[model samples]
Target chain A: MGNQRDSIGDSSAHNIYLTNGASEGVRQVLNMAIRSKEDGIMVPIPQYPLYSALITLQGGTMVPYYLDEPKNWGLDIKDLEYRVKKAKDEGLNVRSMVVINPGNPTGQVLTEQNIREIILCYENSILIMADEVYKNVYSEGSQFLSFRKVLNGMGAPYKDNELISFHSISKGLMGECGLRGGYMETHNIDPFVEEMFYKLKSIELCSNTIGQLGTLLMINPPKRGVEADEVVDLYEKEQGEIYGGLKERAKMLTATFNKMERTSCSEIQGAMYGFPRIHLTQSAIKAAKEQGVQPDFFYCMQMVNETGIMTVPGSGFGQRDGEFHYRITNLVSPTSEMRATLDRLEAFNSEFYAKYSQ
Target chain B: MGNQRDSIGDSSAHNIYLTNGASEGVRQVLNMAIRSKEDGIMVPIPQYPLYSALITLQGGTMVPYYLDEPKNWGLDIKDLEYRVKKAKDEGLNVRSMVVINPGNPTGQVLTEQNIREIILCYENSILIMADEVYKNVYSEGSQFLSFRKVLNGMGAPYKDNELISFHSISKGLMGECGLRGGYMETHNIDPFVEEMFYKLKSIELCSNTIGQLGTLLMINPPKRGVEADEVVDLYEKEQGEIYGGLKERAKMLTATFNKMERTSCSEIQGAMYGFPRIHLTQSAIKAAKEQGVQPDFFYCMQMVNETGIMTVPGSGFGQRDGEFHYRITNLVSPTSEMRATLDRLEAFNSEFYAKYSQ
Candidate 1:
């Protein structure tokens, strides 16, 4: 227990609250953090829909910062500064910034410099909620770094800043989303806030012990040179194969999407998804309006119906005005099926553009 | 998966969202049902602290009704009626009432007629959250009926009333508090509210799948029969011995507490606790005030410090305006330790009262 608590502290100075999943953790913390109508949270524009949906449910304001699409879907420090100032100028108390690293959808890993810049911009008052659930799944050359480490290195500006970093067994080598285990580590938060969090956690009594046990198992791991050598070796080999498969498929899909007409896409730098930007023609937009849906949503729905391929629309994730995109996961199909998925995407795009584009 | 969705529908129709544990399920539905400001939730005075803490954290108002201590800790419909009316008159919208069966601390299980009478007090507009976590643990002659079933039998005032009945693996044979799996069944909820619940559930994504797996395992017990006699018999014998041991020891503890001079203790009914109401003397109360804690909280702290016994304070659970009490779970130690715990309690009570009574 002491070791676990120490690990938690090593995560962030504040208390660690475990949850059923990072999704539940995010929602609960967001609810706890934003108490009043005047309180708002700022998240990246191309963020996980979970944030906006939770913010909407909690009746908190959502301020958004657009990722720099031309800059490999990277965070623009200027945009973060602009949004923070904009929120304050508009009389919204922007309480926190939500950052997902090995970022979702865009899958861009933040540079150490970028991490420092983001922390410096926060002004030591607004808390930073760094979602590092995909920390273990980065590309071969991209080593995962904790925001805690990032802040710890920057010593002076961030030592006193409030930060909550979330990690999950579900995404790591475990690949066990069904396990639904994750923990949040908070740093530099007031003891009063930690007290409230304790009450809040007790409200759930505790997270499912099975998941917590699984997490404990993950953390402690098996002893080195233990008896079950073959079992351990097989588990490691399967994990390596899965990782290699994901990386290759991610590459292929990104290249295919980019080659398509009027379409833009990004490589999966770290996370599981590839989000491709699609430009719908005026006729398609009109048709989508007639169908009472966003063009991309309508397009995705059509693709799902036609090919049984499901993708979340950009609107689900935050997007800039009139910008359209759809997220596809590398986990969707086996390698044999990927060719079919690509062929279908190419067919649908050609057909959609032929009828709608001038 | 289909079976799970079907179960969800069955539960949703019953106004139940199965949760990671009854603790979490209770929190979610209660938060959904209670008022975050002007609305008050009526809980049994000397109730579980879980309800009060959650209500306070969610920004809801809490209205308390004292159990009729003279009537074997049964619900005093008059106290509830008075509290409800008073809260409403004071402009607090009393949204729901929480009834713990085989009461957590008090350990009193109500009769069917008593349940019906309470149900009659709250009609269609107001909901009742029935915490029947100890259904399977009742004494042989003690009957346990679902509030939903009882209300259905009554067939008039409460026939169409909204109710949520909760159950958990934490309290039954499993005693698996760490696993955190439980469920609630709902009845007579509004469609829009039902839709809102679905949306709310989606916000947490879902309870951890392993917890759901536990729930599944619970509802459909293992099919291992006489062929697997050793395993089944071992489980059965262990449970029987544990239950038998609890019943015998609970009797001993309560009998000894009642014999103590300033203590009024209740008999254990169905749940795993024995809440002995301790009457604090003037001097003890004065000393407690000087120490700056509730008399019971002070007594509990002393108990903890002196004996290394970790029991919750009655003040943590709500109580009548002037009454002081403390809760002790019967699961203190093995059968051998029962006499020692009783001796400790008796001495603690006698000395505490002797010092305080004047």
Candidate 2:
């Protein structure tokens, strides 16, 4: 059952449906819509692969909008309009826009104003799929602004816009990725369509019940007495430890990247990832091509070989032409180990550039 | 992770993958294989909904071959070849065959010889997708013989046949449907296809870990010391209780259905269900058409309304033309309540037949 929206000043959680996981929730909702290749869904470039993969798996066209790097990888309405119109011009029906706030890989949280600008752009026509799984991960300055809250902030008719916001127990402090538990909350959907969604989900009978209980434990935890206080106190203490540690690591890593010869990183506002641009030399790009790999991939592989630190290539997420980037996690435990990894990365980059530079 | 195939005499479980459930395991494999509408998969008539639902969702043709009802819902190789040839004649690429042992809805297990004929028919060409989730549920006389065992019994050439066998903790004594735990073991599959499958599964990252542990506990339960003996003793005691109760219910329900007017059920060999064929009059069929419902659906709905017992219509499980049936579980706890329900069903059938026997 889906009643998770009331706090956002919309209808209650009665519109919420538990999914197999965040990915499954996204897949089921997209599977409910996106009938043919004629229909397109907007996704962020350098997005989580699940979004793009499911789109192709469901036989729908993916219309990608790049996150603006200068603006700290924030959504620019211009890019949205460009991608939507570009897709429309090709005779594709731009039925939905997928907005992953507190972005994956990039790790930038959306502003309330940014959310408003997004909703207002296609409030009436396009369905908004907000992947708000990282909403609970509070950042340094920006508090997580749910799309439902921003939609409610617009008031009146904006609340009537079709939205399916997904939340999960997989991320955040719980980090129960293997639990495979998440939920989808829908707003302003027709009762008939809602029933249809229920029937569609029933095809697999139901999502994992234990995962549902895990989500329950998450939303409704021990809160009051000695027992409650003990659990809550321990949870908050860990949160504090991780928050302070991760925030410092984010700053140190960004500074470390900028100090490097051809590396620069945008701020890590929220989420667990830090996507840093690695400026590749022409000769390095040539070496990558000769190895039949993207420059960033080749560079990341070499870094992994040398430093024993794994990273995903920027091309894996989807970067602009001629731009090179790599995503690393803020999840590195033991501060010294993370610092050591960063130090090795710096050394490896210098060696790599010297070896492959023109 | 997929090393569960060793006990069954397959090459190894290195070719295995974990899934959300038996259904999801079946789905991922089918989704990987069935690429276009022109591609066909051989499904048993009156098969579980998962096969058809996924086949349609994955945009593949479902070519159904009927089971030999008189032979206790046994496999018929001629029917299989007929369906396959028909699909091929219609220009469909018949890529694979789906064999649900301890057949879902019907609840009949395949004989070792039956399994041999099935493999021998398509061992060279079509891939075999064996749903053996109910392999542990022993019947009155027939012990559950896995398709893998039969394939091995056929020796080398058949051993080289491509097979994807699925098993789950959802059925058997665990009966943890909502737990969502299962594994798929592939035999003699091409390495290229296995890599593709790994990439596809990587999209969702992993299945429910708690369920995975539950599966682990099932495969490697306690055996030696005091605590281990106590746990094992309790498990065996509960299993014995369920076994004694369920075996009685299966016999009772089968006899009950046979005694009822115009109703017949095959032996409840392995699975939890007893799919009974209900003979509907022509007038009832007309009435069902007037109500804009399938005849079996209408009959099952009426049965539910009259007896407060729910049964899934045969049409829901892909029944043959002109025949009507409904699938009900032998899981009605307490033999008395089941008998009372059966008595109510008998009375309802008499009254309905009196009214609709045109």
Candidate 3:
């Protein structure tokens, strides 16, 4: 672990603490990193709620940048720069940016160029805490690259950017969310900052030892000489199939949703969620207001109540002003169940439009 | 859970969120609860360090009441009242208090009367996050009493106090710390506060499902209907043996330490640690300074480096001025290894004194 971290150009990489899950990791690290004065974190507007909630708990401000929904959930360098500049100008002590690769809700993988641009544009020496736990689950023929790899490929200004990469055993091959296992790998970090991380983690003592064991398993899976080639091949093959299924299901769902009137969704190239925009009618919005619920939330709750399908409302993840959306995870029974869920969503959308939207 | 909290006449009891371990539970709830402006939490000095670290993270203040080390690590009610009033008079918003029964570091179990006094003093308004994870390890003839039980039994101001009881699967019969399983039971909390807790927890979605399953196992253990008597007897017998062994070791270690000059340690009535006062000689302190470490840290690190005995420093947990201490968990080894530990500690103390005093 020490030598591996040293090789990564992070003198304090060895000091990066582990947690039961990325949630706990975020809570601890952010809690340590954020200050009420002169410390804040930037996150994508349609990002994981963990960043916002954890940041809130730490009494730190959250600076949000929009992921262009119309542009396939792509990162716009201009939007990023604008948000960072705005936050700084407004006296929000921004310090770090949380990037979700194979993004949550809006599941678009960043292009290598996008990654390089992010490094070059964010000039204030701000740290990047990359959530790359979904790195292993990319669709075949689509090359998934680590931020570290891209940075190393860039070889200069980008390579020197401070970054902390998070990985998990829950997402890719095992889908072992119940295991509550994850790790943070720091690259090109300062020594004193690393010591602070250790000091902060020491308060919580250590993460679940079992979860750490799972991390060990993920990092050092059965290799050649240690395990049979046939067994390893079977494991890899199973994961590949799972990845293929996820990709196919995501594409099919997005395409199907887009076919519906006033409903649209971005292509889910990576993560397990399909965040679809559902245009609510004026009547529907009025009806939802009467019931004291956001239109999307009302739609989601109604859909769940009627069809027994659960999907999070867009308000759960921040959204653009007046733009309604809901996030549905792709894990809904991959075979017949997913089709049923898609069908239910379509039917609900139509019914909702007829009754309220009209 | 909702009905149970309502029935208890306080919503906080029902608002208890479950986590993979008490550490995570405490971190989350405390972080959430202490977010208000003027929120200050009173924690016992020589605390489990998690308190200070968490309060610091949340930008909350920690008002500490020193444990009466001379009185078997007893809670000084006068000191507690003084601190509480001082904070209040100073306009610091004192929100809650954390009491670790079967105290960490120091293993003194609070007497029923002592608990009653604490409850009366708190006046039921202050939220109490009672950590009773070590309840099962009380000394022989000293039954562990829940704060809820004492509150109900006495029918005083404490019956109205917002109490959250925390328990873990790590320290009791299973000793499965690696599993990271625990639950918090809340009593006498506000409904709105409970809802807030729910909303906060939803931000993390849920604790590990398997850990929740383990909690279910903990709360609802197996019962053999036909072989009830045998099963009961078997359980009782195993518990008795473990409890008996722990008490025996506690007695042995306490007696041995008490006899040593410049060293004094209280009897461990409960809990897994022995927070012993290491009477360091001037020379020993000088030597530790030369090594560039806190005396206690230097001592503990030396113990770990030379003897492979891992122990935490008192500085990690807060301590009185100039009082150097180290936490020694009773997990050194079984009976034989326990003896070896005592021997090593004794020899180390003698050598340390002779070298320093000389």
Candidate 4:
């Protein structure tokens, strides 16, 4: 717990809530922030469907801001500002904005400058929800700078800006998804609101004790002096191996997608996914329209049928109109198996393009 | 899974949903059934607060029907009829009704006749939500007849009545509260509505796999033919001891409450509670009002401070006006320890009553 607090600039125990997963924490925040249909939550266009789905479920207006895909899926603070302004102009209260640091589908780690700009864009007008579940899963050159760290470092009024940063055992080196362990740390949230959050959480009794234990283990892993040298060494070695493997797979997946015909992928800086943009021919789009499906969905269906590689269509996650993509996880194990799967996907894409182009 | 299906009258796997616990299942059902404030749910008075709390959370009107305290907390179909009629008359769509079999707090197990009468009362007009988590916990001579079983037994319209029955590993013989494992079985529900339920469930991904495993183990425990005779015997022995202990404690607590001055408790036929009504004097009520708390709460607080025994005031759970009651779990271990606790409670009650009377 002390290690957890230290990691996040001395977050008080009262401000941290252990959840079933980061998903539950996000839901709680959404529930709290969204009082009516006019309450808006700013979401990334190529976002994880969870955000859109939960926003819809909570009856909140989704003010979408598109990621600049050409700039390696980076946030454009101007786009966020415009969206919030438009939402406000349309008489919607921009209650909160979600930032998936080390992004979900479009996996680009937000730089410190990008994060600072985002905080500046929103200020204290809206709560910032930083989904930092993949905080530890960054690429070699990329770094995962937490919103809390950046906000705290920027003294006075900015530091007091309300933020809720989430982390999970399901991601990072643990990948303990089935264990359903995660937590949210609130920064500068009102005491009354925190009490309400606690009351809402208490309604569900508590997250499973096993999940809580998993969260504890994840946050406070074996350290140098706290354990036997051998134990600490083994823990560090295993963690490093997992992190390294994930990074390699992410890079390999991105490279494979980029190599495919009529497809391009931005660098997967962090997170578990490689959301590749697919360039479908007019004929292919027409065929998908005839079949009453989005082109990306049709393409994904073909890939699943032909190569047995499952991926979610970009339409499931909102995208720019007429632009198509598919979200594929880089979580396939054993480098050789992953390579074979990627190769199969490449071959299938080529044939599908050839057939559709004709 | 097969055993689970067999236990609940050949329920289809598609109709069964494993949840974090029966609480989660109940919440899901409430969410599904409650479309708006106009949608009313019939709840028992002195009910499990989960139902009332969730109903309010879902923004559904709670149509309460009182259990007959003089008749050992038995359901009065006439009372339910009156409540539903009253709600309908007031422009509420009485969509569903909740029945906690082997009741919570009240500890009443509805008889086959009561179940059949209840079905007749509602028929196809309303969905029946049977909270049967305590289906396996019942005192001798008081059999637990599931609403599903009784409904199925009555031919034609009654058999086709929409029903959702819940069970949990946290209750009964297992008492694995922290495991957070349970399930809900839907009966005669529209496939489309079921599909909607599935979609809602998918939004949360899934309940933790460990909870699901616990559910499977709970529903499909080792039987005589499935396991070695000795293993089966040992399991049965342990299970019997636990169930016997619960039953004995329930009886002891009920009897002790009955023996107390200015107190009364119905027979503890099932479940794990003895909600005893306390006869507070006018002076005590005045004192409670001055302190700005429920009379029962004031008394319970005094009991906690004096005897270190904790109990929930009946005000938290809706009770009849002018009545003061407190819910106490008959889960205190070892017969002697339970006896000692009862003795302390008796002493505290006598002193408090004497002081208040004066």
Best by DockQ: 2
Q: State how far residue B277 of model 3 sits from its true place (Å).
A: 3.6
Candidate 3 chain B, poorest ten consecutive residues by summed lDDT? B1-10
> What is the C-alpha lDDT profile of model 4 across B1-358, one tens digit per residue?
5334334457678988888888989988998899799999999988988888888887899999999999889988888888888999999999999999888878898888888888998645589999888855556678877777777777888799999989887883657777777888888998899999998888886788788888887777788887999989998899888878888898888888888899999988888888899989999999999999999999999999999999999999878999989999877887789899999999999999889984
Candidate 3 per-residue lDDT, tens place, B18-48, comes to: 7778987887778667865579899998998
Clashing pairs in 2: A2-A13, A2-A14, A2-A15, A2-A16, A3-A12, A3-A13, A3-A14, A4-A13
Note the DockQ of each predicted structure.
0.68, 0.72, 0.52, 0.71
Worst ten in a row by lDDT for model 2 chain B: B1-10
Error of 4 at A281 (Å): 2.5
Candidate 4 vs. true structure, TM-score:
0.96
**Highest lDDT among the candidates is held by which one?**
4
Q: Tens digit of lDDT per residue, candidate 2, span A234-267?
A: 8778878877787777777778888998899988
In DockQ, how does model 3 score against the reference complex? 0.52
- Candidate 3, residues A93-147: lDDT per residue as tens digits? 7889898987888878888778888888966678888888775344443556677
TM-scores, each model vs. reference: 0.90, 0.89, 0.88, 0.96
RMSD of each candidate relative to the true structure: 3.9, 3.4, 3.9, 1.9
Q: Which stretches of candidate 3 lie over 4 Å from their true place?
A: A1-16, A37-40, A136-141, A224-226, A348-357, B1-13, B33-40, B85-91, B137-141, B224-234, B278-325, B354-358
